[model samples]
Target: MNKIAIVYGSSTGATEAVAEKLQSALGDADLFNAESVNIDDLKPYDFLIFGASTTGIGDLQDDWEMLLPKMEKMDFSGKKVALFSLGDSASFSTSFAGAMYHLYKALKGKVEIVGSVSADGYNFDESDAIVDGHFVGLALDEDNEYNETDKRIAVWVENLKQYLN
Candidate 1:
């Protein structure tokens, strides 16, 4: 099994909760808070799962904003990456899960990006995370549909397991 690390940035703890669930689901994975993670801490991991909650007007969560420049500079050539984000589609329809897009743009050409989820069940006006009719990562609308989060995460993680292998 590959060494996996789940790193996340959360303001209201939604993304962190998801990360915890992922850590539990993926048995041997490590979990880290984005604010405290050092670049060197990620070197041992072959796979990375990043989670964040979208903030004001399509912005990444505060911790992610601080880490973006470092992430952009890091070499992710042989690493595999997956992304997930928490957003409110009902309130922020135009920018739902936008932080995931920011992460995707930073890591796209550098890493083997995985975990693109279907956008079929999502009701959003617009999102930069959408590519070729699919979401670039797992999208969670906890504010509007909290009940669906667990199911969505479970399904997405299962799909991600295939990609990770």
Candidate 2:
């Protein structure tokens, strides 16, 4: 079984809720707050899932900002990484889930990025999170489509399992 680690930076608890749901869905996974986890600690995990809530106009959550530089310096050569993020798609439609894109950029060449979710069901005007016409990871709009979060997470987690092996 792949050793998985879920690390998140949440300001309003929405992202944390999704992280907890993922932990429940993926049995035996470990969870960590981005502020408290050391970058070196991630080296042991076979798979890394990062969750963050986008703030301002496409900026990463505050805690993620501090940890990102450290993450960039770490070697993720044999690991697979997936990302999830919370954003207000209704209000911030243009830059929805931008933080995930930022994180993707930081780790792109270093890790084998996995779980790119389709953008078909999302209602966004534009997003940095989109690459090759798909969201770089699971994109959640808890502010507007809160009711869909659980289902979305369940599906994304299932999809992620395929990439882990």
Please provide the root mean square deviation of candidate 2 (C-alpha atoms, Å). Answer: 1.0
* Candidate 2 lDDT, 38-131, residue by residue in tens: 9888889999999999999988999999999987678787789999889999999999989999899998888889999999888889999999
Look at candidate 1 and give me any clashing residue pairs. none
Q: Alpha-carbon error at 90 in model 1, in Å?
A: 1.0
- Number of clashing pairs per prediction, in order: 0, 0
All candidates: TM-score = 0.96, 0.96
Q: Which stretches of candidate 1 lie over 4 Å from their true place?
A: none
Tally clashing residue pairs in candidate 1: 0
How does each model score on lDDT? Answer: 0.89, 0.91
Best by TM-score: 2
